[model samples]
Target: MPTTEPARPAHHFVAGIGAGPANLSLAALGEDLLPGGLPLFERQPGPAWHPGLLGAHSRLQTSWVKDLVTLVDPRNRLSFLNYLVQTGRIYAFLNAQFDAIPRVEYARYLGWAASELGTVRYGTAIHEIRFADRFELVGADGPVATAEHLVLGLGTHPEVPPCLPPGGLPGVVLAERLDATLAGDSGATGGQVIVVGGGQTGAEAVLSLVRRGVRDIRWLGRRHWFAPLDDSPPANDFYRPAYQRFFHNLPDDVRHAYVGAQVLTSDGVSLETLQEIYRANYEGYLRDGRAPVMILPGRDVVRAGARDGVVTLWCRRASGGSERHTAHLVVLATGRRPAPLPLSAGLAELVELDGAGDPIVDHDYSIRWKHAPRHRIFVQNRGRLSHGLADPNLSLLPVRSAIILNTLLDRPAFTIRDEQVYTMWA
Candidate 1:
């Protein structure tokens, strides 16, 4: 069946390009402040924050207090706490005693907020955005809606390495499809499985295979060890507004160096997730006399291929040697790259690009464009170097959205009061 076109509002004050958590955060914050409202244009039929990757044991790395509106507007009606209260799940949620909320529960919280806002036009795909007196959001079907301002939150997608064959190998799959692919004769239970990447997704993928009775699994990562996320106070200060403010004022080289130095803080697996994996492996060993998962750190999978019933992976070890591993299925959890923005050629020509042909996002998250003064194009999750690791971190979602809102609204819509700060960045 074909996807039917949903009705658009004809026009909006701000036409958010994607309805992911970033734009959803914007809609949550700047909806009332804008003239008409910051409505979202989502390609998906419904609200789903990483629907495929929400494993049974996945938990958020950030705190629950870092919700859609709390850090920026705690009194906002669409807060996670408010969602809990309105849905009659507050007491039940509190009773669970979770150090970190389940990723599924956070997704549900986002969906609930999206439902309450009712500002998202789902199933509406924006392919190319062209600029005129205003911006026109063009969809696959046709030009859908025009807006005075545009915000890009296209979000990220699974990154399958180039070493893999085109369209992926026959039995090879991304980490998100591991479970379903396992059911399809991809050989999950009967043979060894290969999981690439050491991030949270890869960790979950390895654990999932163990749960599914896969006795042999090779978990490969480029790091010296499977590092855990540094969620400590000084480390978290790297996510604060004070740190961002200081970091932004530094030279580009310094900012880049700082981000490179602190990659694990934002990108590493959760400590709890690692502990679970170790405990599960220990239990499996006690029961079956053989550990289910083989944790191979310092191995980077540089090439992969599939033939007959086996998926072969050629990894480049950090200590400078190559090794091969053949498995029934290869799960590529190699992290995600940001989805390409739908900027038209004309719009692209107008926007300033960095040396690498990426957008030159400023301190305020606005892309430096020719018509930025009159018409603005703000982005989310596209600035890790310019901004810090907090550019894409969920813990700073509301704060980042608040910064963008303040830029878009041309006034301080939300006051970010980060007064009590002891650490001073040199």
Candidate 2:
């Protein structure tokens, strides 16, 4: 059994909070490079991935190749391939005929990888960050730990539409925690459901509720039809050496504009889930002579209200017209925004920011501060504007991990130490 080390003072090192995929990738990479390694803190009691939305039909938007560790170190023992082998699913997965596996399975894979790593502190919530001679992580229990480096992986938070009033009605709920919210609901069998937003999560929520035997459901979106994502396979030249050169040489404003254009907001449905939804809707339409589910496209929801278990929605039509509709349940699949960090007054004053309050990071993702020179504070998901299109996605986990690792080690090339490798697997 791996023993837990007591929290003690440490020298120059990196400390990661929130062990999501982004930070988990860094932790796995750090394991192979730093011995008696860095500390990772997670608020959850155990490894859980999007526990609020972990439905059976929920699947990943990207390929399985985009796992935590494989994108960086394919040969690492903690790779997804290794997880499949360890779980005795390698052969079964090969025969399953899936281009992308169910997201619940991927969540399980992440849990398995985290268990193997075994260096994270669970159930510890970091309250605030203080920058002194070094970075200090103050938690609910006081200063939990201090380090020379800090990486924030505090993922996105659910975004409730500003048009809707606070304190949701009895039947209205944001779709972030769909499963828990809808569980044990006898009313949902024949209840009407109105789902807002046109993103992948929105599509998944609609499909999930429909499959659970909801008779009446409607999907409303501003787009005429679902937009597909850029299906071009990994442009190795761009993501690799040549593209880095091009990106680095480009003007700052130009780089910002380019990334802004490719933002993945409601980017298409996965081929698997798309087929399932289309087929189900078509079959229902044929059987009943009318679709139980309605897809109202090219319309923006101007306002919404829920009272007495009925939701009244006011929509502005695409042709400059208006309409009103009502449903028993309303699901706001509006997606998420970046979680806010509670910075201390002193620390907040020192850190530089743009007009929008987003931090200014260098190529290594370190937040630039006026006072702190030796202590490097890095942000994981908060660099969308400066870091380009791959800011918060799983696609750039390995590359970002490499950049952070290089900065921590102060080395141009990251070479794995023998002791680090042994400690990681042991």
Candidate 3:
């Protein structure tokens, strides 16, 4: 069904694109500042959270405590803890004694929060964003929505290897939306399955296939053994207020290097999950007498081709040996890049970017342009280097939202609403 076209207002106070957690956080913050309520546009039909890859065993890599509202304002009512309480799972979860719940659970929590806010405009895709005296948001199916301030939370773009042909190989799925892609057919049950990459997604894919009773699976990667995620807890200090101050003072080059060094490229699986994978593979090998899964580390795929339901991959090994492997399916666990902004050429030229083409944002998460006026056009997720390592992570949702809100309202000492608080005791 089509959305009822809102009577286009002369100008809205604020507008946000892509209603993911980051922008959702900003929307929550806006509720406090704008009694009239800010407008939000989402491309998806509803408050869906990565529906494609909503796997049964896919647990959140980050702690639940790092949800949309907690980190910045722990007392926020729209918190994961609050969701648990509302769902009557607070005691059940406490009894389970689990640190992190499944990713699907988190998605549900986000959906609940979104439902309560009632500010999001689902099924509304902003085709192009233009900034002049005011920000113009052209929708795919409705009248253009204009706002004094705009926030882009378009999210990350999935990265596929150039060697792979467009449209992707049949039976070969990029690990972006695993559950949706591999819904009915039992994975690897028909024949051998190959999973590429060495990130957390790759590892998770391999494990999921194994759990699905798919015995013939081969895991290939360019690196030897899954690289250990930086487990040092103290490193989190960089995300704190004091560290943000220190990081902001560093030179641009230094800041870039620092971020590149610490950011988790793949899903940071917990120690328990890591141990489960090891145990599952080890025990299966010992009992079945057939090593259905082979980890070919230090190998890179040169090319892949599919013929007659068989997908063949040509790879170069670290030992200077070339090998060819065939599989019934191949899954790419490669990560995502930043999504393209729907800005006009002229407006895009006005926004400043780093060497990598990422937006250069100021302290308040507003895109910094030599000619762009301050507080007129704001950005949410495109300021990783400026904000610190937590910029894109769920951990920084509240902080990013607060920063964007304060900037939009032009208030240096703005305070978040106390009702939204999710206290530790609560």
Candidate 4:
């Protein structure tokens, strides 16, 4: 059936590209500040944040206080707390006493907020964005809307390693589809299952396979060992607004070094998650005489291929030599990169690119373009190099939204006050 186009306002002061948490945060914060609202065009039919990746036991790494509006506007009606209250789950949530709330609850909170905002044009994918006197957002049919300014919050997609076949193999599935793929096929987990990628997602995939009674599971990682997340106080300072401000002012080389040195802070597996995997492995070994998950760290899969329903991975060991591993199924839990912006060639020509050929994002998260003075093009979650690690993290969602709003509004609409700086970057 053909889907009906939702009614649009024709022209907007500030329009957003994607309705993920990034743009959702922008919309929630700018709800009252913008003349109408920072309306968003989402490709999805409805509100969902990483729905496929939200496993039953997966808990959010960041605090729930860092929700859409709480960090900036706690009193906002679209806050997580308000969502809980409205849904009559506030008391039950508190009584449950979780250190970190389940990822499902957070997804529900976002959907609730999106419902209350009522400004998102769902099922509307912005195919092309061209700029004339005003930025024109075009969809499948034609020109969807025009805006004075645009915000890119398209988020990211799961990345599969280039070692694998371009079109993909017979049994190779992404971590997001592991559960469904396993459930639908009774023999999917009958033989050796290899999970690639050393990050938190990979950890979760291994654990999920273990819970599903898969006896042969090989968890491969590129790092020396599966490291725990650096959740210490000093490590967390990198996520603060003050540190973000400080880190941005440093030289490019220094910034890159800092990000590389502190990779574990944002990219490592959660301590709780690691412990749970170990405990599960121990108990499974006691029950079945052999461990279900084989923790194979320091192995970087350089190449992979499939032959007669069997998958073979060629890996380079960290210590030195190369090795081969075979499996019936392979789950790729590799990291994600920012989705490319759908900018027209003419508009892209006007924008300045950095040494890496990416857009040069300013301190306010706006791309440096020819018409940036009058018409700004802001980006969210696409500034890890310039803005530090917090750019891709959920910790500073509201903070980033506040900063963008302050710059877009051309006033101190929201003051980003950060105090108690114990560590100096000098």
Strongest candidate by TM-score: 4
For candidate 4, what is the TM-score? 0.97
Q: Residues 1-426, candidate 4: write the lDDT tens digits.
A: 999987764898999999989899999999989988988999999988887788999889898898997887889888888899999999999999989999999999888888889999999999999998999999999889999999999999888888877799988999989989988999997889999999999999998888888899999999999999998999989888999998889999998998999999999999999999889889988999888889999999999889899999999999999999999999999999899999999999999999999999999999999997799999999999999998999999999999999998999899887887889885
Runs in model 2 lying further than 4 Å from the true structure:
1-12, 234-249, 264-266, 371-373, 415-426
- Across 290-390, the per-residue lDDT of candidate 3 in tens digits comes to 75577778888889899998899999898898899998788888777678889888788887787877777777677777555543567665667786777
Which has the higher lDDT value, candidate number 1 or candidate number 4? Answer: 4
lDDT-based ranking, best first?
4, 1, 2, 3
The local distance difference test score of each candidate is 0.87, 0.74, 0.74, 0.92
Off by over 4 Å in 1: 1-9, 185-187
Model 2 CA lDDT for position 56: 73
Return the lDDT, model 3, position 305. Answer: 92
Clashing pairs in 2: none
Pull out the clashing pairs in model 1: none
Q: Which candidate leads the pack in lDDT?
A: 4
- Per-model C-alpha RMSD: 3.4, 6.8, 5.3, 3.0
Give the per-residue lDDT of model 2 (tens digit) for 229-293. Answer: 45554422223323443455567788777665554431556656667777888888898776657
Candidate 2 or 1, higher TM-score = 1
TM-scores, all candidates, are 0.96, 0.89, 0.89, 0.97
